[model samples]
Target: MKTQVAIIGAGPAGMFLAHMLRTEGIDSVVLERRDRDYVEGRVRAGVLEQIAVDVMRKLGLADRLDREGLVHGGTNLSLDGEIFHIDMEKLTGGSTVTVYGQQEVMFDLFEAAGPRGVNIVWNADNVSLHGLDSDKPSVRWTEEGAQKELQCDFVVGCDGFHGVSRQSIPDTVLRNFERVYPFGWLGILADVPPCNDELIYANHERGFALASMRSPTRSRYYIQCALDDRLEDWSDDRVWDEVCLRLGPTAAAKVVRGPSFEKSIAPLRSFVAEPMRWGRLFLAGDAAHIVPPTGAKGLNLAVSDVTYLSEALVEHYRERSAAGLDNYSARALARVWKAERFSWWFTSITHRFPNMDGFDRRIQMAELDYIRGSENAQRVLAENYVGLPLD
Candidate 1:
């Protein structure tokens, strides 16, 4: 098969890239290792920055999101029984975030792209990319025991962190930077009402705990734990008790019980791969960089990449100019690094270190107190949380 662009991975980045390409009259095919059901059902990041929401609405994929997604103007940061509200609307000139799961966003994009004549290959396994430096780049894959090769003018690597796309680039041309945190977040989605009107990020002597929700009836919460911690070691009762302890008395009053569905531990880390492009192949989303979930920047960063990449691809194809494509690495990196800094800042302030003693705990509380007392600090948090302006 031949196409103008061959997209690896059917995640948000790849799917949104195909959707944007379709609008620009560009032909592309998306290949996914997993089936449609798996991709649509995976529960992950749930915060959409203003830029992400705007991009989806502009792409005509926000009908369901507009109807179902929850909008928030601010979030609360609680430390040592004190609360500080960072008003995003006030700081960003009316910009606010939408609380909608990444899975729902993928569902909308997948459905929108299907009827537009985009070719999506689900359950295509062991896909291999080759000849990126040659005149004809090709993708090889197997589906239902049938092996085939596809030739394309350009290839986009959006296959995520563990995918083959990142490794496809010659190791000689790549530089990697990574820092793993000492802790992980044990996230849980329960069928109870939310503990707060908006998201609450609490930092206490015990650890960090986040009070968030997926919907009016379904609450999502997380507590800091060891990176290797398992759900089997944390029963429902233990989870709730820890959540209550870390959140302190303010959140204790709002706690409720319900059927819990999803439970997983996510390690905190920051990862970036330099020059995001190799020959005719470009990397997007988790293929390029990764940030911890503390600042809710993961999904937003992925959306930003495809937004810029699709625009660059369209410009390159139409004007026969590689300027946009050539600058993709630098342009995307600016935002990526800013988000990396923000996520790290938030994580450091929220999570406890291994040797954190009473003195360290007091220092954290003082920092939190200063943040709550200072308008400039609140503005900084508000701006980063709502999102930096998309270039």
Candidate 2:
């Protein structure tokens, strides 16, 4: 197969890029190792930053998102027993975030991309990038035991951290900076209404807890747990108990627990590889960086990277200019580091460290207190939380 661009991975990053490029009459092919059902069923964070929502709308993929997604003007921060609201919209002059599932966003993309005849090869195996540093880059994959090859003007690695794209780059050229936290988020998905209207991020002596919802009728909650903790050790009852213990009486009293449909422990990490671009090959989304979910920047960051890359490609094809493409790595990384800092800051303040000493706890408290007491601090949180402009 031959195309203008070859995309690996079918997650939001790859999906968004393919669709965005398609809208510009650019032809591309997507290769995914997973099948359609698996790709669509994966449960991921739903907090869509303002820029992500705008991307969906701009791509003509926001119909279902508009009808179903929840919007939050602010978020709650619970320190000790007091919950202080950071009015994001008010502080940022009406900036807001939409709560929409990543899976739903994929649904929107597939709905449009499929009928338009966008080429996406699912269940592709052993996908490899060749001649990335050369002008004509290509991808090779196995499909139904048959080896296949795709040639493109450029290759995109949206396959994520564990994927092959990043590894394809020569070791000496790539530099990695990473911090893996000692704690992990023990998260659960339940079919019940959330206790609060807005997301609540709670910091307590027991641990950190978050009250988030997928929809009015579906709730998603998380509590900090040891990295070694296993799902077998945490029953539904136990999970709810820990959540309530951390959130305090006022918030806990409102929690209506049901049988959890999904439960998993996600280890937190902050990771970025310098220079997202490697010759004709470019990395976007989790391929280039990863942010802890504390600030809900993971998916949003991916969308933003896709947005930048799409524009760069459009500029290259439309104006026959390489300036945007040439500057893609530096540009994406600039926003990436800002998000990493926000996620790191938010995670540091909200989560309980096993090694947290008295002074550390006090500092965390002081950070939250400042956000609560000072309008300027709240404005910073609001702007970063709602997301700084994609531009």
Candidate 3:
């Protein structure tokens, strides 16, 4: 098969890229290793920055999101039974975040892109990338025990961290930066009412606990723990007890019980692969970088990367100039690093360290206090939380 661009991975980044390109009269084919059901059902980041919401709205993909997604004007930070709210709109000059899951976003995009005649090849296991240095780079794959080759002018690798796209780059030209935190988050989704109206980020001597909900009837929560921790060891009773302990006394509210899902742990890490381009192939979304879930920047950052990448690809097709495509790495990196810093800062402040010294603990407390006490500090958090302007 031949097309103007070959997009690997049917996740949000690749799907959105294809949607945008088609709008510009460009043709692209999306290849995915997973089936449609799995891609649309995977539960991931739910928070959308103002910039992300606006982009989706402008693209006509926000109908369902605007109707079903919850809009939060602010979030609460609690420490030792004391709560402080960061008014996002007041501090960020009218910016707000929307609570819409990544799965829902992908579903919406898939629906929108399908009718536009975008070709999606599911269960296509990518074998290799060939002819990257040439004008036409090809993707070799197999689907249903049959080999196939997709030839295109440019290839986009949006397959994410574990995919083969990143490996295609020569080691000498690639620069990798990574940091693996000492802890992970044990996340659980329960069929019970949320503990609070707004998301509560709590810091306690035991560890960090986040009170988040997907809907009025379903609640999602997380607790910091070892990377190798297993869920089988922690029963439902133990999970609730730990959540209550870190969250403090229920007071007017109470912890509701329901069928609790198995706990899953995600190790904290921040990673970035330099250039984001090798020859005619370009990387987007998780294929480029990853941030811990603390700041809720993962999905939003992926959206931003594809937004810039699609625009650049369109410009390259129009002007026959490589300038836009050439600058993709530098442009995307600026926002990526900003998010990395924010995620790290938020995680460090909320999670207790195993080797945390007295001075370090005190400093973290002081920083939190300053954020709650000082307008400038609050604004800093608000701006980063709502999102930096997307160019």
What lDDT does the true structure give each of the candidates? 0.90, 0.91, 0.87
Error of 1 at 122 (Å): 0.7
Across 73-119, the per-residue lDDT of candidate 1 in tens digits comes to 99999885566788889877898999998888988887877688878
Models ranked on TM-score: 2, 1, 3
Q: Superposing all C-alpha atoms, what RMSD in Å does each candidate have to the true structure?
A: 1.1, 0.8, 1.4
On the 0 to 100 scale, the lDDT of residue 226 in model 2 is: 91
lDDT of 2 by residue, 341-365 (tens): 9999999999889888999999999
State which candidate, 1 or 2, has the greater lDDT: 2
Per-candidate clashes come to: 0, 0, 0
Name the regions of candidate 1 deviating beyond 4 angstroms: none
Query: Cα deviation in Å at residue 98, candidate 3?
Result: 0.3
Q: Residue 131: error of model 2 in Å?
A: 0.6
Model 1 Cα shift for residue 13 (angstroms): 0.7
Q: What's the CA error at residue 40 for candidate 1, in Å?
A: 1.3
